[model samples]
Every structure is written in structure tokens, then in C-alpha cells.
Target: MKKPKTTNRYCKFCKKRTSQKLAAVKTGTPSSLKRGSKYRMRKRGLNRGFGNKGKTSRGALGSWKRYGVKGSKKISLKYTCGDCKKVGLSANTIRSKKLQFE
Candidate 1:
């Protein structure tokens, strides 16, 4: 949380104090590559009619190996407007573990 190279703030299309330029809005999807437990597999059907095969979830005692992606990557802040150049987004949402805009 260190984004203050410029933040006079109030730039509703340059209506007042403008000089905002700190950005870091990296919003979603970055956890290596989500979903691949084979749809929690378990599909060996039609043994005497057709055919189908899939397997993965071995829970209850294996707990399905506890998959991945508990949810992450949600940081925001992209306020450009240096004078009606317009671009805003840092109204409210300030979770921080890291975010430094120099």
C-alpha cells in the first residue's frame, strides 16, 4: 500500500484537482491456471451399452486431494486523469498485501 506519487484526487473528468496517475488494477485470474480436477471425475458408465471413462474425486477419506485456487488476485486502483484524460477506479476497495505505484 504505497501509491502516492500523485493523488490530488477529485477528477470527475477534470472538474477540479487533477494529477492522479497511480495505477495497479490487476483484478483476476492469475492462479497458475484454474480448474483441472477432471470435473471432479467419476464417469465410468455404459459398461454394457456404450462407454465412458473419467475419474478424479476420491474424497470422504481422501478429501479429493483438496484441489486448488482458494481465491486471490483482486487488487485495484487505476486513476489516470491528469486533466480530463479520464480514467478512474479507486473509490473503495483497499485490501493490501502488496501494491506500490511509484
Candidate 2:
């Protein structure tokens, strides 16, 4: 879907309608040093020598292709208020295969 680069929207910070810049909010990257990742590494026997690490040792139960996946993702919009210079996120989310800012 295509959207305008800027639009007039109600800004909570400004307490009035203002010209806002539109941008797509992207998902951030996960850090491998996190606790969950560390535990997964240990279970997968990627850390040290192991005899039998059980079911999780194989990592995933099946190939990624076997699991049903969604073609699109829920994307939210970020609005930068022209008056207050504060950032705000849209309450509603849009599900689309591709989002373009025009």
C-alpha cells in the first residue's frame, strides 16, 4: 500500500491537529546474548560436547518450509508531530505484504 509522506493528524502532545511525517515502524533485532538465546544454545548442544541432548538437540522439530507462515506482517505507523516534535504511534495496525511511503 502507498501512503502520503505527510498528513494532517491530531497530535496528543500538541493537543491539536498538525502536519505529521509518516514512517513505517520496523521490528527491532533480537540480541543473541539474551538469556533465552543462551539457554537455546545450550539445549541445542552448540556450546560444548554432548552425548545426547534430547529432542531440542535437533534444534527445530521440522523444516521452516513445513510450518505454515503468514505472507504479511502487522505494521504500525510512526507520526512525528510538526509542532511538538514528539513521536507517537498509531493505535491501529495494518496488515500488508508491502508498505510504501510516497
Candidate 3:
């Protein structure tokens, strides 16, 4: 088990140093959301060489892996100042498994 790291930093609004709570931040929208809700709507046109209505595995994952695995990105957290309630992120990229807030 690893210990959680918290930062005590300067808060501009509070005009003093304060404890900042760390939290994981997601970078972008989910993969399923990058495309519109395909199942929800009944589409009339072709999607990926076949009609969108049929329930089938498109084998897109196999072809997609031809490029090789992408690099694993470290999880980033948003640090919110306790005193001023202001949110801040690290100037440098820092990765953590989890953040335990007190």
C-alpha cells in the first residue's frame, strides 16, 4: 500500500498557505461518447461497411491494435485549496494511484 500525497500550498484568495485536497481528473469524454449514441437511435445509413441496425462485433479492435499499444498515461489530480476553495492543478504532470481526502 502507498501513502497518499497532499500538498500544502499558498492560496491567493485566502492570502495564506492551505491544505489542498487531491482528486483524480479525467482528460476527455469517454470512448463510447466520442460517437453519438448508436444504439439509441435507429439509423438508416451504413456504418463501418455494414448497416447500423445489426448487432455484431465490427472487429475494429483487432485492426486498431495494428499500430501497437499506446503509452499509458499517469493519472492526474486536481488540487483544491481548503481555505479559499480554489481549484488548482500541478504545473508539472504528476501521477498517482489514488487520493485519500481528509
Best model per lDDT:
2
Point out the higher-scoring one by lDDT: 1 or 2: 2
TM of each candidate vs. truth: 0.26, 0.68, 0.49
Query: Which regions in candidate 1 have their CA more than 4 angstroms from the true location?
Result: 5-18, 21-76, 88-102
Instruction: Show the lowest summed lDDT stretch of 10 residues, model 3.
Output: 33-42
Per-residue lDDT value at 53 in model 3: 36
Q: Compute the lDDT of residue 20 as modeled in candidate 2.
A: 99
User: lDDT per model, in order?
Assistant: 0.60, 0.76, 0.57
If ranked by TM-score, best first, what sequence of candidates would result?
Answer: 2, 3, 1
- CA lDDT of 32 in candidate 3? 51
Model 1: residue 30 alpha-carbon error in angstroms: 12
Candidate 2 Cα errors over 4 Å, as ranges: 31-45, 48-68
lDDT of 1: 0.60
Tens digit of per-residue lDDT, candidate 3, span 1-102: 143556787777787888977776776733352333433222323444656533323444335433234444466667788777888776665544443455
Steric clash pairs (candidate 3): none
TM-score of 2: 0.68
